[model samples]
Target: MSGTSVLALRLAGPLQSWGASSRFTRRTTESAPTKSGVIGLLAAAAGIERGDDARLAPLAALRFGVRIDQPGTRIRDFHTAHHAVTGASMPLSERFYLADAVFLAAVEGDHTLLTGLRDALRAPVYAPYLGRRSCPPAGRVDLGLHEGARLHDVLQSMPWQASAWYRRGNRSPQALTVLREAGPGESVQTADVQRDQPVSFNAAHRRHALRTVVTLPVIPGLAAAGGSRDMHDPYAALDAFDAVEALEDERP
Candidate 1:
């Protein structure tokens, strides 16, 4: 309750990876974007270099929530490299990613800070990637800065950012799912604790703490479908041909 502003970001990309528990030989991605990754992106936009713990602290403190408009398919790639020390072949590694994913992320904090972040995203100091350097954002990243908004409110209010194809296929156009980082004193029935709280970004002393997150079901008040009409029956012609053939067979 320090301030009433939330910075919204559109995290849509061709390929994105938000690693939660990556090991030496395996880099896995979470099904949805992680707070660690999104905070890192904000830090980058604000021109905070890696390992700058002092500057990252405030950004990491902001409340985070994500709306999974499109939880794109998971994809993996195999990689092999030589060890730097021994010059020997290293163990094959598998890197995971989400393809054609779209997410609406919100960071609720002080009005001044959130406004600054929105401006920084519009004209970033360093190019911000989705989660890794190689996976760049496909569309505009800055959604806008909303004053008098809270974490849950922003997540629920933001319009759905699903892909055109995905939206067209939806049976109900007036629904979207939101997953939020549980805050203090919130009545959470079920929540998953994730170790994504950033302590220090120092490579040698990097650390994280556990954070509680809960999933909220679809919120109402979505805009009506637009000009893009849903596709007609996919098997209409085939079904008609099959009926004609059945009728001819019965005539014999």
Candidate 2:
């Protein structure tokens, strides 16, 4: 009932696409990672294969939270044929634009598993990435754990305000200001974060797969029995889930 959990820090980045059904068209869109895909990534890092996923049942108990940053904007280049036939110069059009976004993922689960994952991250059996191969974490994982706290409470407690960045000593740390929906025709205040400078897209393309890195969060109840994962079919694995009870007064 009492044990430590592993904290896997994923630094998501801009230009990363986690599309579910993008293969049909060359066009891609942004979406959350699928359970199968994420687990597959983990398995690959561990030098495992598809069949090994079920063996990682212990990881199922982890709690996962994705904090999106860098809400990226998409850019597209087109090719056109002039003759409207094969191999002819044609007109090109902007297919679509996708917003660049970053995700900070905290995986809270078994302490031993977390430790193993942390170690694996440092020296991954295979090169690992947040959402794409090009992006890298801005900094090393700032990981920790907490007990007796709900997931929502932990999220709110994190220093989300822009001022906290300087106060927390991340002077040069990249930050973003998020805008939320209040109501129609209503406005919310967001800290106007100035763009630091023009990023060298060429250099980013050459050195990395993505433009920026992602920030992660505190994962609670990672090491408890079962696992702490955001598995889509969590109800199917209830026995292994953390024993945290949903309170009547708790708001979703």
Candidate 3:
């Protein structure tokens, strides 16, 4: 492990919430995973605590990207609770999540550092969650480690990680969208600016800066093929996904 490497992740789960702008009573989620959120996840896997910014800096500097393999439905919920100290009812919170979504995430950086991070994920000190604590990963996050690889190459060339149910009705790579960090000297006019770059993860003063992102197609081995994707309800495949899971569980 001497040079650059990319660590890919499979981020499919029953629910996910990547909130960039969270308020006191209303928490909203971004459509895809955020850099800050994903970095925080890696830090947790590496056993870095919330207040340890010194250990968090290297993970934060890694380039990040995510492919929307399955852009799940946005659903909302109302949360009500009581304050333990005061025994008073807390204000109602309106929370949002992406249900039945599957994402492919990747981070690129020093090979030696990435290797240790991957090993830590295999046996994490603190469990990883989607953007919120209530949402957990449906399965293992590790995809594989690609040495001497770059983020763009790994994200685009990897096979579509969408669920089998999603593949039945949709083109895997053809219908997918990749949201990635801008390349060197990429025009700011072409990329969308979002406030997700993590500066610190200390609970007392969590901070994030802005980063530019560009959207592209997930056409890897296939030649440029032009066609329209069939529009279907994001929640339409719930039953099928459940059925598939049952079959998997029943297998020896």
Candidate 4:
């Protein structure tokens, strides 16, 4: 590894769409965030224009991985548009999205580069989105930056970041599924391939190359972080209700 730092991001939203490939009028989303999508987010935060391939090269070189804290359900919708000048009806399009999903995205690279990215994320030159412009992050994307840390290690050490309600329903100790770029010297048949490795973000000549990805089940002890605190019981807060009785009596 050439770099020794990692940047962590908490990517959660009511609706997110990460499409590695878009076919004509049909756009489908992946179950988790893709490397190219996250790189696009960082590039936008740094104010790098879509056509600036030189600046994006270093960002694309960073190792990318994501922990699926919560794999929200997939939903679809259809959309149609009309030509602005001609006022002619356009073909209908189908789009898919993930609802109520939460993810922990991590990238490891040079310390200086990662630190700059962390700052840009805090106050981005351009607004950041989950995967598309329509799917803005529910909250801040910067969880923190880890100096002298590796990509998978930082991702594995984070606490469960799922929403309160979602964790309550699934109280069991769960093993989070992690998808990360494979390390050097892995067998070709063992690693999966994705064409999301960005070659250029230019809308006119957008291109991607294949990448080897390895799936690992990490964070098996999620129950420690998903204990009773996140569990939902109808009367779980009744003890505190007694102290608020005076305020309740004054309600108009």
Candidate 5:
């Protein structure tokens, strides 16, 4: 595509569930939002019906990436239901969700499509949810459009969307983690592979493909450290105290 633009989305919610390998009895969630979940959100914004393959194809082809600003804790719930036809009780089912998480998602595509998507999200035809209908977005879903930006650039430039408490706990104000979809034949240094790409959303013949996602560390508004130090090291606190004392001693 020529002159691509990225439509940025802030997917912060109380309960977000992006299921990857869910079965009948247990519904699990991926640590990060899946490609299928994101595309489905776009489709909803565009008013595409469930089985509308023609309208869904373009959205599915977009390059998707997600930055996990805050990797929320996983919470599970036990639920039981009764059969509709009979009075038989169904087995207990375990549902998983990420509580109080914030993700920055980028969908890079043509400028026209990106602008259209931004507008649609602002006043979506169908109400958008954080994966499941029960889990709705907690904040403004659209973060506006980034013109002529690639996936990596968008991830790096987007501001941190973590909660105030989470940001306060961070060692550095600029700390952030990015998870981008790897390009073709690109060597992935550290990544987790997931099979969540949607080939067909048809219930009768659902299909997906494998996608490689690389995790990257981004430090905005700060220079890179000379060397890495463990934030959780007990000695680090002592070292900081020593440094403060040395500075105090040097002061006039």
Candidate 6:
């Protein structure tokens, strides 16, 4: 048996509050940590604790992807606290309200960990959400596992729709245009012009990077090609990959 790798994703909506900062008179909002937070969620699914961060930190080697579906609107909350005049227990004050927000996240990890993590999502013992208690997941987890003769092969052929805002220059070259100008496996360095300079977007770059991730071929058992995986240790059993295959195979 060999180990597998898969992409684990979750889409959340409604209202959320990360509660990154809070004070007696003022408060603030913080977006969720797409990388660390998803890892922590996986740790929780694996029954890992805060103290286990070091032990499980190695798992970070796996690639992570997050898609903020709604990017929910931000809102402000208000609150107040009180103290007893007699030096006794202080009475609670009135509750305040804030605006609603939502976020979506996707994480890629080892197949074994991912498989168990996916099962945990079905009936997770803990509450796995985007950011706040009020904001809940909009739908089921969106999990995907590259399928082909090999992981690298699948990644090389993965589909990625180009952005519509792209424009080619007369004398300069762009990353996406380079992808179109040159054949596959080509690289380019765009010139730093004033107005015709190339543009980079995190969203598009994330998608592009994700498509190239399969190039790394994290799935175990597959023979390492072009230094994609560890040549010496490529026969380990991958739970996440196996689970993804099983799940996809069963899907219509």
Which numbered prediction scores highest in lDDT against the true structure? Answer: 4
How well is each residue in 6-85 modelled by candidate 3, as lDDT tens digits? 99988867899999978899999999999998888888888898888889889988989998877999999999999999
In candidate 4, how many clashes are counted?
0
Per-residue lDDT tens digits of candidate 2, residues 15-41?
454533343236344443323334434
**How high is the lDDT of residue 86 in model 5?**
100
Give candidates' CA RMSD values in order: 7.0, 20.1, 6.9, 4.6, 8.7, 17.6
lDDT for each residue of candidate 5 in 1-252, tens digit (9 for 90 to 100): 557888888787789999977989999999889999999888898898887788888888888988887799999999899999997999999999999887888988888988888899988999999898989887678888888888788777666666655555774455577777876577877788888887777778777888777887775433322122112233557878999999999999
- What is the lDDT of every predicted structure here? 0.80, 0.39, 0.84, 0.85, 0.80, 0.38
TM-score of every candidate: 0.83, 0.46, 0.85, 0.86, 0.81, 0.44
Which lDDT tens digits does candidate 1 get at residues 1-252?
346688888787789999877989789999888899998888888899878998899888989988887788999999899979999998999999999788888888888888888888888999999888989986678878888878887777666666656665774445666778887688888888988878777778888888888987766337532323222334558878999999999995
List the candidates ranked by TM-score, beginning with the highest: 4, 3, 1, 5, 2, 6
Candidate 4 per-residue lDDT over residues 1-252, each given as its tens digit: 345798988888878999997878999999999999999999999999999999999999999999998899999999899999999999999999998888989998898998899999989999999888999887778888888887778778888878766666886435889999865564545668999999999999999999888888886334334333333334447746975996898899
The global Cα lDDT (0 to 1) of model 3 is 0.84
Give me candidate 1's TM-score against the actual structure.
0.83
Model 1 / residue 48 / CA error / Å? 0.7
lDDT of model 6 at residue 52?
46
Our tally of clashes for model 1 stands at 0
lDDT of 6 by residue, 78-128 (tens): 444455575654444322222332222344445666666677776676667
**What's the distance in Å from true for residue 124, model 1?**
1.3
TM-score of 6: 0.44
Q: Candidate 5: minimum summed lDDT over ten consecutive residues — where?
A: 224-233
Of candidates 3 and 2, the better by TM-score: 3
- Model 5 misses residue 175 by how many Å? 3.6
Off by over 4 Å in 1: 83-88, 171-174, 224-252
Cα displacement (Å) at residue 214, model 2 = 21
